[model samples]
Target: MTDEQPDRKESGFKETTRVRTARERLRETVAGHDRTERVPLDAADGRVLAEAVVAERNVPHYPRAAMDGFAVRAEDTFGASDRSPEILRSAGEAASVEPGAAVQVHTGSELPEGADAVVMIEHADERGGDLEVFDAVGAGENVAPVGEDVESGQRLYDAGHRLRPSDLGLLKSVGVREVEAYEPPSVAVIPTGEELVAEDPAPGEVVETNGLTVSRYVERWGGAATYRDVVTDDPDALREAVERDSDHDVVVTTGGSSVGERDLLPEVVSELGEVVVHGVALKPGHPVALGVVEETPVVMLPGYPVASIVNAVQFLRPATKWAGNLPVPDPPTTDARLDRKIRSEPGVRTFARVSLTDEDGERVATPTRASGSGILSSVALADGWVVVPEASEGIPADEVVAVQDWEALP
Candidate 1:
């Protein structure tokens, strides 16, 4: 474990704090400690599996017909076609099963005990008890053999796989009524600071929107947002909230993370639990904090709306996925030419909101004005954000940058 001691002189900010690289800080924040639960297949949508799901039996269960036609030995219809037809009488030699077969089978019906192929209805003609066969089919031409779709004892899905609609259908087809899935990690979000309030506040009071946004993200990531409330910038109150909400797997507190007299979140977190990480080397979200309270992971984020959200993407999102036993997917990215130059401080990763538009049949990005930490509206208005690496001072116009997707493309 790397040290998170304060390194105030690195950035020349009035308040100096130790900061870890984005990846290092994220690694220090551990996943929630929780067990698995069994959920019905229908309710397991979007949930991650805790165990492998194996097929109990083969798909289709038996060899079946694949078309409405006569089931017969492929050799019997040899040289059969429009110009060269084979006439076979339905006498004692070939019993009259249906209009033209020893026995006619509809599509999907089980093939007769000895049949190896099906002669489609279009390939046969009935003429007063005498059948003319044409368009000969080879063996296994129209037969769906047992285990053709899936084999018995096959591992249909492995642990840590997120269930999709198609996966549900496959599970249903394989007769899986319930599955072992990781229990949804319970999360408690506490929005702190005297300037914050749950309800509409007087002028200058910022409404508590971070908790709502965090809650939605938690739910979307397959974790349950069990509690959301506001707390004043008091270490005692914050400690009380942590102790009371220790039942949850993770607790999040927004605001009061900076090293100011009013910023007592760090102190409260340390008093109640162990502070693992204090800050991150990322623009708009440098004050992000990580700790553990009573064995439950606790994350403290900056008060600014954009900062909170960006930190959520960088930290909370992955933590939720890990808690749910889900295999994390690479963050969505797209390549587009930069429309203008954007500067950034060295040694800090920057996420800039950008609007993607089609200019003369090419996709171009327009950086939004709400690139600041306080602007939440830009997140909704922009298509996605562009990630600027710490190694580069800035990105020049016409340079191809990978833009993260925020909404469905137009």
Candidate 2:
């Protein structure tokens, strides 16, 4: 709350805010929204649970055979061997196993009553209505007892746990039909700029892609995104757009955030609400801004494609997670050796796109040729990006670094 506010009409930031401070303020503004909904198990994957899931019934309601075998009393198979096999009368699928009698059962079949163990068909021989066991069996062997997989009243998952494919399967096995899941945050993605068009852009006119890109990412990050039409850089239109979508959990406007005269999002946002952060000390996206309107967090991204995407990952993603009561997942990463040195500003964090390759016997990361913020292909074709800390000037060649997969979802 104490961060100095940049002048709305200022052309550039004298001192940018740290990435951590911007994120903290953004999270604080959007946190504590606890809306939830009942979601069927089929559609619950990747959703965050709103409450603990308890098993109401055992996974295996009855004791069953784990594999195809003959059910027999443990005592009947004791001392059984190839040289002196123990012989028992065949019960032939009887409802229950009598002492010294064996009942046939298949995999997953209910274990016959009175059967303490199972002798595999491979270890037993059938001869004139008699079964000869050549292997000793212990009680409960080759059988799946009741509650073996999930016991009744067992807590399967706690609040904030993200559901996966296997998690849904297990929940269904325990008689769970649906789950109480946090509702995804709603976002309005508005791309601004007078020179932006939808398609078939002529000279000096750029196709409107920042909104499309940011909206898609909003959905991928577990937010319901309403992709709005491209709004002109006029202050009145920009303010109207923000006010129109203020009901949403978050409002993200891409472009028109820089210091150029055409860049007007920072000023527009200031008029309608308080801008928490005007610029961040991050490479390629320092013009990004964060604000709050009617208790809803607003994220203004840079006009450049790469910078917009980078700021979305840094600010919008976590804000959406906080609003939806979902836990933010760490991006997936891989360790690789840098093929070449990467220069970076000492006081700014940098995300240098790189393509991974195997050279000789080592995994090497080669920086992309088009590393500028406006170069969409640089990030499009890159496998991941190597992060340079604010304290480091550059990473030397052959140094091992963790490459973060920007598109990965947890």
Error of 1 at 98 (Å): 8.9
Show where candidate 2 strays beyond 4 Å.
1-3, 6-11
lDDT of 2 by residue, 1-410 (tens): 23366454553588888899899888778864688999999999889999999998997999999888899999889999999999999999999999989999998999999997888889999999999899999999999999999999999999999899999999999999999998888999999999999999999999999899889988988889999999998989998999999999999999998788888887777777888888899997898999998898999999999999899999999988888877887899989999899999989999999999988888899999898999999998999999899999999998999999988953
The best candidate in terms of lDDT: 2
Deviation (Å) of 106 in candidate 2: 2.1
Off by over 4 Å in 1: 1-22, 25-34, 88-107, 121-131, 406-410
Against the reference, the lDDT scores of all candidates come to 0.76, 0.90
TM-score per model over all chains: 0.88, 0.96
Count: clashes, candidate 1: 4
Candidate 1 per-residue C-alpha lDDT over 1-410 given as tens digits, one digit per residue, 9 for 90 to 100 = 12355532343233323333444554555564559889998898988888899988888788878988777777777788899987754332232233334346678887777678877878887777666887887889888999889888889988888899899989888778899988887888888888887677999888889888888888877788965668887778888988888778778888887767787877777777777767776777888878877777778888898999888877777776666666667667778889988788787778888989898988898888767899899887788888888787889999888899843210
